[model samples]
Target: MSGLTNNTPRPIDIRLHQASRLLEIKFDNNMECQLSCEFLRVYSPSAEVKGHGPGQEVLQVGKEDVNITAIEPVGNYAVKLTFSDGHNTGLYSWDYLYDLGRDYEALWLEYLGRLSAAGIKRKES
Candidate 1:
């Protein structure tokens, strides 16, 4: 909901498991989360994905097989994710990442619901 603060949690470890297409992140606060590439790709904060404002988000389809091609740090506050589809614009800040990790289940379910409502399907790999 808000930007990172002085007491915000920071990642202590980040591992990309290419075979599984999951990025495992462990924070200094001892919280750990394994987020799938599809999840990250669909929820990307880039303007291309999220658009310019609320209610402008582009519905991403056929990204179930996307993978993380690279992970680059953005100063000390965020990490830039390079996806297999050549999209690398989102700068995932610590707070954002944490929220993604924390709210993954609900968010994913919501995505699925939206997909179903739109008559779209996640293309299986």
Candidate 2:
């Protein structure tokens, strides 16, 4: 399936491995990514985390122990992720998820930099 952009691909499969604390997503184009719950939590697309505008994103710290408690489809375009920390507002669109997967490394490094700049440290469980 095609997505929002011409290059984006729709997700074909999604699996949550609670024991491994990972969420795996496979797209129709055969590209796949395995993301940790901690990463998802910190990069949540919700207003509570991402804020309403650019430069307003709240730096999410202490989410190393966080886990996704549920994944509810929000129609054919997105899924609402419920975090164990009580965050469930972000509706992860197909495009957004694909971007997350494709840009995991850079995004993660950016997150780490933000944390470091903010003098925050992730708390491991």
Candidate 3:
């Protein structure tokens, strides 16, 4: 995953809606997205999920009901999310978050494909 770039739009506001299990973020560039907690958890930038290099991605499973327990800011560039499943290693930078929102459909579909191919059925949320 890429880090912050010169044109990366910073988040103007970040709100966690616990009841809805969504993270609503609005960027300075007028872009906004509501990302599900499950989506964020599975796409976490942590080494445990992303691995150290290419083709080493560890497919996350059974995270449909996972929710964010905490959101701690790391400097001005990123936020560290603590999930209910105890995952708190990923530093979700602004650019990464933006990309995730921008590419959500494709990423989510890919994840679903992987799960299907592995014969892993996601629990209903």
Candidate 4:
């Protein structure tokens, strides 16, 4: 996980990698984040993406090749990313982004488990 704190998410610099479906974000404190298309899709902050709460976050599959089409700011506190597959509802807040970057591994593992339980595979078979 990156050294993302409140200070780290203060100013976010985002870059798009079309070929690999990766979005790289650099924070104020120089914390670089290389989030994959699938990761962003699955971890989207939208109500539609996050679901109602824990245990409801739907497993997003077949998004490994998805690309970030656009990045729009949501006021002054967050960002909205549009994917090539057409999902752009999520508003990723500074706090949420920092938390995700800080606890990337644990949350990612938890997501993997949930996917397994739901019998949804990440990569194409």
- Identify the runs in model 4 with alpha carbons over 4 angstroms from their true place: 1-8
Candidate 4 C-alpha lDDT tens digits along 1-125: 23434454565577788787777777777777777777778788887866887867666767767788898887877888888899999877776776677677887898889888888777762
Candidates' RMSD to native: 0.9, 2.5, 1.0, 3.5
Better of 1 and 3 by TM-score: 1
Q: What are the per-residue Cα lDDT tens digits for candidate 2 across 1-125? A: 13577667889999999988899999999999999998988888888998898889898888887889999998888999999989888888899899899999999999989998988876656
Give the per-residue lDDT of model 1 (tens digit) for 1-125: 56999888899999999999999999999999999999999999999989999999998988999999999999999999999999999999999999999899999999999899999977777
lDDT of each: 0.94, 0.88, 0.94, 0.76
User: Which one wins by TM-score: 3 or 4?
Assistant: 3
lDDT of candidate 1? 0.94
- Predicted structure 1, TM vs. truth: 0.97
Q: TM-score per candidate, in order?
A: 0.97, 0.92, 0.96, 0.80
Give the clash count for model 4.
0
lDDT of 3 at 13: 97
Candidates 2 and 4 compared: the better one by lDDT is 2
Cα error, residue 57 of model 4, in Å, equals: 2.4
Q: Candidate 3 lDDT, tens digit per residue, 1-125?
A: 56677888999999999999999999999999999999999999999999999999999998988999999999989999999999999999999999998898999999999999999998887
